[model samples]
Target: METKVAIVTGGNRGIGFEIVKGLCQKFDGVVYLTARNEERGQQAVKKLEELGLKPLFHILDVTCEKSIEDLAKHISTHHSGIDVLVNNAGILDFDKAISSYEDAKKLIDTNFTSLLTISRILYPLLTNTARIINISSDWGLLSNIRKQVWLDRLVKDDLTVEQILEFVNEFLNAAKMGKSAFFSIAGKYGDYKVSKVAMSALTFVQQRQFREEGKDISINCVHPGFVMTDMTKGMGDFTPERGAKAPLYLALEAPQSLKGSFIWHDCHHVNWDD
Candidate 1:
């Protein structure tokens, strides 16, 4: 039998770190904890090692194509294929000190676009029954998209990834042009919310594509809830450990029928269109 391998991007800290720890303890395979910074990734692995839970570390800067390719190449060379992938690397609007347009671009690229790029790059390396869990947010729900037309387009069962990409590009263009109307449509944390909305939508798109391609891979997006992390400025209803529960469940335990769904931190299925 081939060795099962799992990877968690942005796994050096916060909920990502907690998920890595959980996988190290429960997953029946090698768990890799990936992060953008080599030092931080190694440090996180050491922390888990001290806890007597072994998790391998790798450098993964989600926004960088070269970095993602390197990780993909490493995985292809060392393992049979990826059994599980947790797309958890992301950023909040306040995490950077750039202009609004630049900030919005970076946020959208990191939180949303990187998911597409990394998945596409790693798609060939996924095992037949692989599971992909995208870390989305409640803000990603279509309800956050106050515009009905936008909601209608995204809620379509036959929604294509191209449509989702176009929607994201439209939002970025609006942000660049200072269109307050677009901001009003997305409401608070506009850029972040839009990016996650795109991520959740992409989940459905990928699942449909996999099904059409005759692959057994299952993909789902999750709203990990407002966990107390640097992203939330440490103000939230749950801790990192609590936040890790649902994602960990999906990664290691959820039934394959759970694909293309938006899940809550408690593992409840949520209607993404609502």
Candidate 2:
């Protein structure tokens, strides 16, 4: 029997690294630890090897259309069909205000838009009932999350991907005019929170689209709890390994009917309305 295959974008560091490790341990298949930098990608593979795990490095820069296309071609030619795609590659930038249009645009490209690009390019390589998991954040909640304040107003239902993009761009435009960080860009810096919100919404829309088309593929979005990693400066309540748990659960354990939903760590269902 042919082994299964998975592609993890931005798997070089932080939570992406932990996700790669978890997938390798739990799934019997090839896990492509994709990174834009060739050296970093290899380094991650080396680290995984030291742990007696098999991880192959595939250089991928999700923002580049050609790069995604090339990876799709490469994967199609070299391995078995892809069984799972973890859209983990993204960025977080902070400015005094969202008026930094250049920086804000970059965040949108990587965090929200690039996912659609990667999925489009790689969709061809996916086998029957493939899974696509978008890594989202709780900050994307509609309610403000300052420090440890839990937001209870994130509307996860009734959001389509197009609506989310519009929201992100609107925030960018609003931030340009100093209209409230497009949803709390003041504290955390950059468009991090807004971008996550857009991605989560997009995940729902993509799932709905797939279902409408009668495809059996499972598509969903999830937020990993605060975990210690380079991104969180190792200060989160959970370790990178622990933070990776929810994504791992979604990728390998979640049921098919649960597809196209916004979920929290460990595959817990989330109320988009909150």
lDDT of each: 0.89, 0.76
Candidate 1 shows a clash count of 0
Q: How many clashes in each structure?
A: 0, 7
TM-score of each: 0.96, 0.87
Give every collision pair in model 2: 93-190, 94-190, 154-274, 155-272, 156-272, 156-273, 246-266
lDDT of 2 by residue, 211-249 (tens): 787888888888788776766645678877877888898
Give me the overall lDDT of model 2.
0.76
What is candidate 1's lDDT per residue for 15-43, written digit by digit as tens? 99999999999999999999999999999
The true-structure Cα RMSD of candidate 2 reads: 3.9
Error of 1 at 145 (Å): 0.7
Please give the distance, in angstroms, between residue 97's alpha carbon in candidate 2 and its true position after superposition: 7.4
